[model samples]
Target: MLPALSTLAAPAPALSTANTGFVLICSALVMLMTPALAFFYGGMVRVKSTLNMLMMSFISIGIVTVLWVLYGFSIAFGTDFGSVVGWSGEYVGLSGIGLTELWDGYTIPVYVFAVFQLMFAVITPALISGALADRVKFTAWALFVALWATVVYFPVAHWVWGAGGWLFEMGVIDFAGGTAVHVNAGAAALGVIWVIGRRIGFGKDPMRPHSLPLVMLGAGLLWFGWFGFNAGSWLGNDDGVGAVMFVNTQVATAAAMLAWLAYEKIRHGAFTTLGAASGAVAGLVAITPAGGSCSPLGALAIGAIAGVLCAMAVGLKYRFGYDDSLDVVGVHLVGGVAGSLLVGFFATGGVQSEARGLFYGGGLEQLGKQAIGVFSVLAYSLVVSALLALVLDRTMGMRVDEEVEISGIDQDEHAETAYDFSGAGGGAGSRRAVPAPDGLPATPGGPASAGRPAPDSTGTDNATGTAPHPKVDA
Candidate 1:
């Protein structure tokens, strides 16, 4: 008995270390998503704020990195003080918490676990910027990011994943981050759009994308990294990696593509490149929470549902008159809802234990739990994000000067340009204009470069056709 107690007290090797390693790898993959996101979003906007577009993503990496290290994780994953928040008991300043593992039946480094989790923390807010693109001020955005992460993101994360977390106790299975990351981010995107108001020109402008190839490249990278994002959520590599998740990702995306194109064919009469990208992303979002939970056929149905819903929901901004410039609210939010709710019905067996869905005879219990969790998270995130946005808007202001906006925030704010390809400035300071993310310039009829030569702006263009400047909001 004495020997047994001693052995038990000696502390088994940290299972969460393996958890940490896998998480660390997945986290790095998720971090790669930010740059991938930069290209994705950058390609969707006008050429004027191309650098600013990229900066929004890069800034989140910076802002959330600091905040997460500080107290973001504490408030998020610390011991629960109540259902709404976590206490500041562990991982503060990277102290005592790393000595023990954070997961069960895995031997991974605790610090590794923290860092892997940290990567997820960094990307969530960046995903919301899709809506408020091209107008928000840099300093205001930074402050808003800090506050949003703390007040909104932290609490919600706590409720879902932290010890004594309500959602965990309630038996809701997230798999990855359907309600926590995507849904929460989506709702916040809507709230921020409401608070910040529309862009300088809303429906009146012909804001076309400047570079389709760049957008596609970003999508490709996201696809590659997402294998890590979803499969890695299992906390360790397993035989399942090459099985259900891999197939589900493919079929769901394919189904969504078909659904979107068919919808466009019936409604708009043309399958625009933008529509294709949006559809693919919609499927990806819907599949996130259901990665390993349901059968491929179920995933297909979920993808079809999400593709149709998100494609339609995107128009809500226009009808409602909010300027979510990039549709973060539409795709991520709507798709997240569809995925999470569908999994509740379509799950193969038990609650987080792969509870069967409605069609699978799991009854309404799981579905009800899913609905409760989704709306609760949505409401919580919307309220917190709105309050944070208003705080920043009132205190420091959220938009740039109108004149600066017209001239382009890159020139007005960052004082540097993204392209110098043509030697337009001659010596050092002159530059040129660029195409929008999906646009290609008609250079004397040869296959056009996406960047058009601006008479006086920075004449820099990346390998893609974009002529961007590395300017954040000012």
Candidate 2:
């Protein structure tokens, strides 16, 4: 009977080609975020390993994109087996479900939804790499990511998004993946830092960012792509509803940016570019779960709240001795929770299709559901992520050998360099970098230049440079 009904299902039955086009565009926009993430994270690392860090995000695109087609979608959105997870039957091997899919009355091509979701899969785990930067064997890290996707990410995703998943059955309202994406990834980053341990010379040295503009650039791209993330959740531009989400996304992001900078200036005595970027991310994270649920004003409040809370999260490691080096845990996990629970309190005023939070007098029911969603993802992610880290550590080791640790991964792992402006010259490699476009000699550690190159094992030029990029260690 199921097979007979499946044959009767029409192609593109629930939506039109026009709607599929919109979803396709949105999915593409989300895919761009991985590269944007590359710039955001790449610029933060020492020049020696910039490519290596950026590669992490890129590899995710390669690995998870394939996995999603194979069974990731099944594991996540398939029919529920009992009450805990799905049966992998909704669209086996991407069969039966094609150009027509009814995610609701508003449907699109199944492939459109599949491709759109694949981008999310690629990015979530990639975010964790920032925590254990500048160390860990590449091969070990690669295998670890694969294992992690199946063991940790898939099951949790099932619980949150799958029809049969317990969280979904309980009516947890995570419109854009608060628990599934941000909280899950953020908590896992914490687990990674725990198992991988600190970077070499962590506290002993200044450990400053190598670039600021790169950070800003990344933030800019993420900001642009986020329109797709928030607005596209509706699957089309067919109505004022999606337009509202788009506007709310921008307003909330701006509010969060302001809040982050305000707090930082008051606490640190300077308005930092990095802080601004991170604040934008915090706003984006906070609004994600609440995007479909909040009014513009409520979104503004949510963004502001997230910024302040996440700003405080950055200081957690210093106070508690846990090394969430990049604060993935601090910002995403914390901000996502703030948005997730708070939405229950503020879902009033033009948010009917949305759930109401307790603050608006909805009482404890929604809040309790939100809390359960957060803790379940947090607990499951933390435990599974820790086990993966341990497996990598126990089997092939986590951190690289001590001597390799001292050298950058680009040199040791990739056997390459980021910049080669000098090219082989006069039978000896010239260590001198090119002059600035303004005809000024590049200065190491200079304001206009990437941080000065550290002396190499052989004292050659271009050895251990801190290229200006957008990365901030927590």
Candidate 3:
């Protein structure tokens, strides 16, 4: 056996079935977050704009998937191009990957890693849609998703996670995507809203969420899917890091929710369901970047701080005069910054990497690195996203007509409505009077009412006779 030198050479690495399966499942969970986002944003807008808000998130799935298969993957994870971007002909269309080819040093196949990362790319641009609800045209929004993913998301992703990227090479830690996903999307949201201007009846109108239940459902699902999002970034469970990330994610979220509710009680008068849901999401966002690096207690601190900060930040739209329709900037941008920066103080230096945070005796060096990652991504996304919005506004007109803005965007944009009172009269179709038992008067005081008094233009059910709920300050 020793006679032949070829026989002694090391063989290729074999795939780890366990790691591959784990990553694949995580990919599916992350994919579910997109539709969940649709539900979250859909419930926050007025009845007229519900479907449009949903479509904004739904359309990103289609646009980003196609782009990822073509060149998005390459631009994000391909061979590095001078630290600014990545490029590799083999990664284009994923044609060069093989069945057994593992992802560099990892045991899972390259295809598995590519698809898992794809889910992250899909949801990034969708996060921006919450700010532009009820205003932007469907076609224009779709085009913006494609362009933004190409220009902003892909490049920023490379800078954070891709091999040889500047931020990655510089040792700025981001276990998941606090800086890359949340901050990037939040800054972009601010930029787009600035260009498109405020929603109709911005300050004067009492705009309220049409459905809080839907918002809660979406938040719940996002919490579930995020386990996969945060844990899967480690690529495998061979080490205990993924398990630690999972635990930190849960602890931080719970702490953040409690902290937010406490703030709401003191500042606002009562603890609203909307506040609870928003607080939970704030915790999730804050934990995303620092979860892997911090201990459970550290995660709790980060989550609590982010929760209070975001709760206060949401009111800034009114003070500063920017229409962030759904508090994307408050919860995501502020939460992300809070989480990314906190890593400098909370990182244990024993979990994901050896780098210690300030509390762990590493001093300000790591904190400075984190700051560099945060501001660079924020400044770049804000400037580039605004420029893209400006170009789109000039070319095809970003906003719907003013008349359409007043009358429900769902009907005009998608030709469908979220609900129909046409049949409120008690039949499947036809709102005409039912003849009222041999044509006698159906109602005591009036001839058979027309479909139980359809909702007025203000979207309040006429039958209830109660004024619409006052808009929450959030």
Question: Pick by TM-score: which candidate is best?
Answer: 3
Question: Please, what's the RMSD in Å of model 3?
Answer: 5.0
* Whole-model lDDT values for every prediction: 0.75, 0.75, 0.87
| Pick by TM-score: 1 or 3, better one | 3
C-alpha RMSD by candidate, in order: 7.3, 6.8, 5.0
Tell me how far the alpha carbon of residue 458 in candidate 2 is from the true structure, in angstroms, after superposition. 20
lDDT of 3 by residue, 298-371 (tens): 99999899989998888888789998888889889999999999999999999999989999999999999999
Candidate 3 displacement at residue 171 in angstroms: 0.5
Ranking by TM-score: 3, 2, 1
Clashes of each: 43, 14, 0
Tens digits of per-residue lDDT, candidate 2, 1-474, equal 357776887754456778788878888888888888888877666666677788888888888877777788888777777766555565667876745556644567667877777777888888777776778788887887888887777777788777778888888877777888899888888887888887776644445556668878998999898888778878777767778888888989999999988887776565777888889989998998887777889889999999988887877776666666567777888988898888778777365254567766678888889899999889989888898899889888977887876766765776665655345331213444455545566642233444444522222111012112223322
Ranking by lDDT: 3, 2, 1
Error of 1 at 425 (Å): 5.9
> lDDT score of model 3?
0.87
